[model samples]
Target chain A: MGEAIVVTSGKGGVGKTTTSANVGTALALLGKKVCMVDTDIGLRNLDVVMGLENRIIYDLIDVAEGRCRLNQALVKDKRFDELYMLPAAQTKDKNDISPEQVRKIIEDLKPDFDYVIIDCPAGIEQGFRNAIAGADQAIVVTTPENAAVRDADRVIGLLEKTQIAPPKLVINRIRPSMLRNGDMLEVDDICQVLAIDLIGIVPDDEVVIKAANQGEPTVMNPNSRAAIAYRNVARRILGETVPLMHLDEKSGVFRRVRKFLGMG
Target chain B: MNGKSSITIKGVKEGLVFLLDDQCDFVTLLDELHAKLDKHEQQLAGPLVHVYVKLGARQLDEEDKERIRAIIRKQGNFLVQTIESDPVAEEAADYASYRLHTVAAMVRSGQTLEHDGHLLLLGDVNPGGTVRCTGDIYIMGALRGTAHAGCAGHEEAIIAASLMKPTQLRIADIISRPPDEWASAEPWMEYAYLADGAMQMDKLTHLHHSRNKVLQAKGV
Candidate 1:
């Protein structure tokens, strides 16, 4: 049976859709047939990130409402032969479809794909519920900020109610300089707050923004740090042991020496 | 007044209220009522069954009421509702009536565990999670959330945990110190209680050193 994984972050702009796009792409590159489902109805962005926005003819709502066949709504990605995406509807309200409807659509697509990645919407509302309805696993993305971590804590708490066994954590947009200067939360701090297993640590990279603007996920580029980190995340999901990305290695020996001394 | 006063029934717009006689033999009257209810079971069966089974109109304490509620639930067709006349008065009356609720699962963030009596959590309470109780709070695992030990104004209630690093801690009314820096180490078991109207926390070792004093205060 294919596994459905939901990439979610309770706080907005914390790289949920980004993670979903990259992870799904990486899985497809790993030779597994993957499908990316955007459950962020009413505020869709996954299609654009994957550079498949213009190719969308029918969306998830269309398939759920029986307006289109399940395979008819799946937009194939040009980059990978095995990769597909089901875009969310931008014209309807989030409440138009229920979690059961989303689950049914994913169930219909499960047998044909090896992995299904759902790009969840922000907040723990109806949209979030729909994204997680058919998910066998969850990846909670959060930043080092206190507010974002607090929301991540809440989202993890909610995910516990559904018994998503040991959901992994992804800390995104982390600045190593800030951590070295003792100005921001470290990975350990976030783990202490949210007692979850660490899966991915994406650094603050301008390449990701550039790729997003060009309607491409950074994971498509092998040279991008974020792309490498996401590939590591995809590997971890496949039960591989990958060490955490070294996020504190900045330029300059003076800063490195200072960091060594400040490691109290 | 009828001599047979073991049971009196009154009709309300919503449903019915049955007042049991306190002077009669309790078990006998209960069995009799249970037998009486069995005869009319089909007539009362419905999606909604609302009724009041007051142990004593105004004198029954919280435990008694709870026991009566349990009995009503055990009956054929009745949804027991304990009508509280005054929240304050009933709370005051229920001050000494407490229960020890044991939950064997980790309390996650965004989730809340609220109880009218003592709460014993078998797992860690993560950050951003809140565990509120009217009486004492005990956590078998780590404590990293907001915990209100005496949520119902019971200052004597205490909170104890194996690892007590809370984001926020409250004893009765006072909010304790802010969450401490995240330490990636196994902290010793800690306990939180009130002393001189202020919250005080101590490691289990120190509390064990002053066992007489700590025990005296703990029983308060």
Candidate 2:
């Protein structure tokens, strides 16, 4: 059985799609069998971000409604043999999906994969509920901005109400220079306001944009700073006691990765 | 029946009197008193009808007092004169010792609490939720929300939360606004109290800080 993780953010455009794609790729590179599901039914973008949009012959709606099997709808990653994706249906609305159906799909995929990361839709509606229904853990993604942090705080409250304890935090798109100048909220400020254990802090990098546009997750490009951060986060999820990465510098990917892997 | 009237009156010369005993059923006693009053119905009832209810000293707990009040109010036509068997001063002292402290099972977001004594909450205090306590405030769940403690100027009063990440915490006249940075640290119990003439938070331990609690309840 695998860990079903839901990448959720209450506010839109806070890098949930980017995080899911990169983290899923990172975990698969570590030799873990991974499946990424896009729960944003009508507004699907995970497939596009992963560059698997043209290859989707069937969507989650078809598999859920029994028109096609789960395996037939899964789009295998071209770069990684262990990575696969179940893209959301752009034509279908969130109401067409149910938590029970999502749970059944994740349960079916559990024994075959080591990780199933669900990309949650924005807002605290049916779409959000559907994404978390099949998951064991939640990764709340937020930015350094107040609006994103506030929305993340609200989502944390809702998860607590649903009895999902200790949902980890991922602060995405952190600009260190702005933070140093007191222009952006620092990591400590976000944690203090959100009050959750942090899992990852992906710095704002041009490599992330370049990699996403190339249909390759930034985590695959070992030279990328955001990729190294995602790799450290994956190790943390695997129960490693890696010290936090320094987001200030753009150097030391190998040294930090070794330190994270306990080989340093 | 002790008195010949529907309202069985007991006279106490020194203090207020109430007669509630285990030997006599309250219903039967009421019925017999009413019968006696019916027998003496020939006398025209005057103004100021005083019906004294006798409650024993031993039966002065919450349940018995509420029951007696309920029964008296239900019994029509009786202008009941209720008296406590226990001394009022002693009762007031006891009541003051243990004030009303109730924490709802689920304290949702936007919920506010203004309590006098020790406030103990069992659920998580989410962000935007607030709890203001005059005495010590103890939350069994995570305190990731906002809280105000020792609001009545009890500086010695401490606020303890299971997991403290309050946006703003006020103790006495001091407030601690959360620093603008992420705190990558392990979860630990946090206790906030007055220190160095301001509010301070420290890990929960058997540590002591000698600070004067300025509680001005009387004209000094």
Assess candidate 1 and give its lDDT. 0.82
| Candidate 2 chain B: worst-modelled 10 consecutive residues by lDDT | B87-96
* Model 2 per-residue lDDT at B129: 73
Recovered native contacts, candidate 1: 0.82
| Candidate 2 CAPRI-style tier | incorrect
Best by lDDT: 1
Collision count of model 2: 8
lDDT of each: 0.82, 0.77
**lDDT, candidate 1, residue A59?**
93
- Give one digit per residue, the lDDT tens place, for model 1 in A1-264: 798899998999999988998899998888889999999888999998888989999998898888989989999998899999999999997899999999998888889999999899998999999989998899999999989998988888789889566689999998878888999998898887687899999887777888888888788877667788999999999989999988755334334433544632
Which digits, one per residue and each the tens of the lDDT, describe model 1 over residues B7-61? Answer: 6767787778887776667566767677657666776677666787655534556
| Cα lDDT of model 2 by residue, A106-201, tens digit | 889888899999999999999999998888899999999977887887787788766555699999998877877889998997786566799999
